[model samples]
Target: MDFKLTEEQQMLQETAARLVRDAYGFEQREAFCQRETGFSAEFWQQLAELGLTSVPFAEQYGGFAGGGVETLLIMTELGRGLCLEPYLPSVIHAGGLIEQLGSEAQKEALLPRVAAGELQLAVALEEAQSHYQLHDVLTRAEAVEGGWRLNGRKSVVIAGHSAGLILVSARTDGQQHDESGISLFLIDPKSDGVRSRSFPTMDGRKACELYLEDAFVSGAALLGEVGQALPALRYQQGRAVAAQCAEAVGSMEAACTFTLDYLKTRQQFGQVIGKFQALQHRMVDMRIELDQATSMAMLAACVADQPDSVERSRALAAAKFIIVRAARFIADQGIQLHGGIGLTWEYMLSHHAKHLLMVARQFGDDDHHLQAFSALLDVA
Candidate 1:
């Protein structure tokens, strides 16, 4: 397969990079870090104006009709800029889940709003102890007269405070973590008994711990059957992990460029620091890992749409593992090479480092992906 990006992808990449630099520069980013919402309304509106809200949906669904490739390009650019927006979780995770699993009416009602960026959605799936396990859900969902009553707590819910709709995971049967009990729900965040408490994240994104005290949901809230939500959850995991890899590739690339220029220009011991043998080797090491991560990210992006679950999972896990390992090295070495300046908030290297750290924590750590890879096949 030709790995080259099409003309449109390249153009979109450049456009997104420029928009992020222009709109979300250091001062603006710092402002977001201090704000209660941790997201810019103006920026969100600008994204809506740019039609970014519509990229992954089909044209008939009021979207730009772009698929995984287009979404990947946009996400890469967003990562390159170290953007603090919630596009991937809001659009890709929540929106894609809706597109993939929601019933016809469910899709029609919510997707158009998602496409237009009018309604923001967040996934309230994670529990306290589990690490990206979809089938091990503990949130309980009981059948009511007309629909269902959802009573469970969700941890690490992305964009929970700002979302209009929440794609929640709940247990309908069985006590322990098993396949039969877990299900997905699309409930209003504003519904009675629903509460979202904001937690300050390392990155400038508003994540929350959600409490659902007898939250009522209609039959339309059911995203898919209890047994089928795992597939959708897996798909969501793939998109998130792939997007993190893309972001890491972009951020690490920028970090490399920045470090090289710093070394080349800065003088130490009567010569340019970059001329030092140790630093040159460090740069080479960074390049090697960065390129490997880049290649794996592209592979995952390409195969993310494949119908075969094993092929997709294997590729996705590989991408996630490689990116986590390489990005950690690059981020650590970048900060170390920058000396004390990297430790300061005034320099953006530290900023990028923190964001990269957040990326490592996103779907799961390197260890989690390693185990995930092992679990992919029961065979030796």
Candidate 2:
């Protein structure tokens, strides 16, 4: 497979990199994170105006319809900048779901709004004790007079509180852990019977625990067919995993770059730390791992757009597993090499390190993806 990016892809990468450099300086990033919403509306608008919000959508929705590689290109830059915006949750995950499953009318109504940055969306899928199982849904959606009444709770709904619209996963038939009955619904977050408790995450992002008590939605809210949401969920989730791997690669790159710069400048025993053979070896090791992780990310992006579902899942799981391990190693080495300053609140490395650790657990962690990869292989 070809590894080189196309001309358009290169332009997208350069645009994203320039935008982050100009707008997401370390101090700017920190300020955004400290906000009550944990991100800046203005920054999100800037991204929208820059055509970022439209990257992965179809042209009819005013988007460029760029695929997984484009997503990787954009997210890597976002990760490097420590961007606090909800682009991942709002645009990639939720938008992908809409694109994949929404009816033509649903797409017309929502996709354009999303592209224009007028709407932000989050998916409420994970429930308490579900771990990383996408099919382990306890939320229930029952038919009502005019629509459906949803009841149950969701945990770690990323960007849930800030999203105007939420894509919720619920069981419409079978029991929890059964993929057959799982379904997806679009709900108004501000509607009655919807309660959200928000909190900051370790990585300076926000998430919410959502409680749905008889939350009512019109028939239009159901995405795809009833009891057939699993396939779309898995597809979007695979895209998310690919994006995460790319983001983690970018984070690892930043960590290594900044740590290397610090080593060059930081002196001990009348010599720069970088010149020390032992330290040099460690930095080389970090770089080696970064390269390997990057290769895996590229592979994941390539496979992410595959037509075959099982092939895509296995490839994504492998990439995620590699990325999780490499990101943790790079973050740990970055902090240790930088000494106590690495742990300080004001330092960029601290944020990147923390974000890297968080990325390991996002979507699915190292162990989770490892098992998934192995299971796929067994089935193959």
Candidate 3:
């Protein structure tokens, strides 16, 4: 079977790329990122108008029903422009969680609104201990009179402060690291006793430290069964990482393109530096690595929505390894080739570099994926 994008997918890619390239141009991104909101509400609303927020959902919920492939396509373009939006966390992660694990009623209640960009959300699943391991949750969810009460702090909750809702992972019957009794819950961020404090990140993304003390949520808020959501959560995370790989691919490709263009223009000893045979080889190598990384990321994107656990983990980890390694190499070479200008804000190289760094480490970096790869392979 062919691996190329379908006509619709191509349209999605072109549409998203054009919109960001034109509307969220480099200057606009800088201005928007420096704002207090930390993202562009107008841009996000435009995405919603374009049905991007609804891409991965079904038509019944006003979504185009685009799958993980669509998300990857959109995210890659988003990375190229470094658009300051919370599409991944607010739309992809939160919406995916609701669709895959929420009850039918819950989906009907939350997803349609999310697809419309009416309710911004974040997945507050990462605690101090929830690093790389979904089932390693320490947050406890105890049954109370009207609902469940949460009492743990979630660290590094991306965009948590701006979210209207949060999907919290909690342990009901399981010990700190046990798989049994691990559960996912939906909580209103505006509810009593649920507080979030924002932290500015290196690359301008806003994360939060969430204090969920007596954070009450209804039983209807439980996503999937109490003990059965761990694997699903992990699966969603793999898809998220797959999207990140695509984003990294785009960022690295842009950096490579930027470096190549600079080399072609910057003169050394009265001749363009790109005229050198050695420099030509280096550019070609960077191009090769970027293309390969993008191809691997596309492969992972294609397989991310698969329900088979083994395949999902392997594909995501493999793509991550290829993409992360290539991204680092290409980015470093780009910076070196560009000389000091690469590090200066007057150029876009530094912006792309920071975004690439965050994406490289986001879900799981090289070391994290290496562990996952070993676990999937059953090797020591």
Q: In TM-score terms, which candidate is top?
A: 2
TM-score of every candidate: 0.96, 0.98, 0.96
- Candidate 3 Cα lDDT to native: 0.84
lDDT of 1 by residue, 1-380 (tens): 68677897778777677788789787878887776667787888788888877877888888877766777788877777777778888888898888888888888888988878788888887898777677767788999998999887889887888888888988888865777667899888878989888887775667999999999988878988865687778787787777778878888888888788889998988999998899999999999999899889888888776674776897898899899888889989998888898778887777778778888877888888888788886532
lDDT (tens digit, per residue) of candidate 3 on 114-161: 999888989887778667777788888999988798899888888887
- Residue 342 error, candidate 3, Å: 0.9
Quality of model 1 by C-alpha lDDT: 0.82
Candidate 3: which pairs clash? none
Candidate 3, superposed: residue stretches over 4 Å from native:
none
Give the root-mean-square deviation of each candidate in angstroms. Answer: 1.6, 0.9, 1.6
Question: What are the runs in model 2 whose C-alpha is more than 4 Å off?
Answer: none
Ranking by lDDT: 2, 3, 1
lDDT of each: 0.82, 0.91, 0.84
Q: What's the CA RMSD of model 1 in angstroms?
A: 1.6
Residue 267 shift from truth in candidate 2, angstroms = 0.8
Of the candidates numbered 2 and 3, which has the greater TM-score value? 2
